[model samples]
Target: MSQCLNPDCLHSNPKGCQFCQKCGSKLRLVERYYAKSILGQGGFGRTFLAVDDFKPSKPPCVIKQFLPQAQGTATLEKAAQLFDQEAQRLELLGKHSQIPELLAYFTADNRQYLIQEFIEGDTLQ
Candidate 1:
């Protein structure tokens, strides 16, 4: 069962909740473990290299947070929608050698987060 990550949430069970029973915030997909180390930060947002809590022996992951400034008013709503839509698209593109797998996507504290399988020993500068 998934537990609500929102601290203010009263409902913790994963059974019948669409949103937190107490605060109406969306529940977070719990990872068994993750250690985030900042990879880089830019006007767009920050990138982190996170060790998978679910499988520590396995490689880490890359998580990117989109910056509000990068998402301007002209495209805020549309960008947010597309950001989520692209994550879904990546999920469908799973395990392809040319495509990095999409691990998870959720919004917390009004910011969207995307977690993707990390390509170890890779550096983008």
Candidate 2:
């Protein structure tokens, strides 16, 4: 299942598609994970339920796209700092059983993304 990253897309494209069916957004990320669906959105970014294409079973993972609501030079710097801080926190907390494990964190195509082990359950609403 290829997920369209375009914020306006309403549907995901067919599996293995290079482009999205609805908005024509790229379907692959970092040439490994395949965005399957929108998991949720927050003030900082949107999370996607993705699959690790590099894995044989295509294990599910959470992909966090950094799309901060604030847009200024200083704000962007702070966002990046916070993002890195969170990544470090996750890396430390990953040793525990409660929090999800951080899988990868890097920038691609000028966009920042953080990948982690997906935890399956209802959100704590």
Candidate 3:
């Protein structure tokens, strides 16, 4: 199954589908990463459990969608800046064994996404 990346839709689609059945939005990001389900959501955006389909193994990964929910323009800009900062920090820190490695970061459909290594097991939160 494929999970739609559209925030408003997020409709589940059958395997081999290229677009969402309900919303018609493209299921694949960059024609590679496919989100399976939402992992968590916060003030800035949502983290999704995704897979890198470009790899032969189709390894699991995390996709961070920058969807700030701030009210004012200034607040939203700050939130976006913070999101980019986080991605930059992750790229630098990922070299450490404990930090999840940053895999890809780019903008798609006007939305910014940060794809990173998926860490299994329980979360500290």
Candidate 4:
């Protein structure tokens, strides 16, 4: 039985609630599925490289959780909405080889997180 991570969830059925009863967010998985390693940190948020447990043979993925500082309540709310929207957009772009696929989006403990496919390659620095 997996509990819905969305705070706004109305249904209490942890085992069968896929979408939040109030917001309708798909809520079957959470961060524990990934093996996280801190990759970097910046103004917007921190980046972590995590193993994609959902795919047994697949490579690791990246999860970015945005920082909530330096913004007013309205700005934060807008950013949250935009973040979710971008996740949806990225999910649609997942088919392309150049685009990283969006895996999940959820807010827990007052922070918003976005999980995406980690593209493995060299970095110029």
Q: What is the C-alpha RMSD of each candidate to the true structure, in Å?
A: 8.4, 2.6, 2.1, 8.8
Please report, as a residue range, the 10-residue window in candidate 1 with the lowest summed lDDT. Answer: 27-36
Model 4, stretches more than 4 Å misplaced? Answer: 1-31, 123-125
- Estimated TM-score per prediction? 0.58, 0.88, 0.93, 0.62
Selected candidate, larger TM-score, 1 vs 3: 3
> In model 3, what is the error at residue 21, expressed in angstroms?
0.2
Model 1 over residues 5-120: C-alpha lDDT tens digits? 44344345455454666676654334332323567766556666655556648567777666545445767877777777878898988667667788888775677878887765
Where does candidate 3 stray beyond 4 Å?
A: 122-125
Output candidate 3 Cα RMSD: 2.1
Best by lDDT: 3
Query: Considering TM-score, where higher is better, how would the candidates rank from best to worst?
Result: 3, 2, 4, 1
Q: Ten residues in a row with the worst lDDT in model 3?
A: 116-125
lDDT for each of the candidates?
0.61, 0.85, 0.90, 0.63
Superposed by TM-score, candidate 2 places the C-alpha of residue 27 at a distance from the truth, in angstroms, of 1.1
Whole-structure CA lDDT of model 3: 0.90
Evaluate model 3: give its TM-score.
0.93
Question: With candidate 2 superimposed using the best TM-score fit, by how many Å does residue 61's alpha carbon deviate from the native?
Answer: 0.5
Colliding pairs, model 2: none
After TM-score superposition, what is the CA distance of residue 7 in candidate 4 from its true location, in Å? 20
Q: Is candidate 1 or candidate 2 better by TM-score?
A: 2
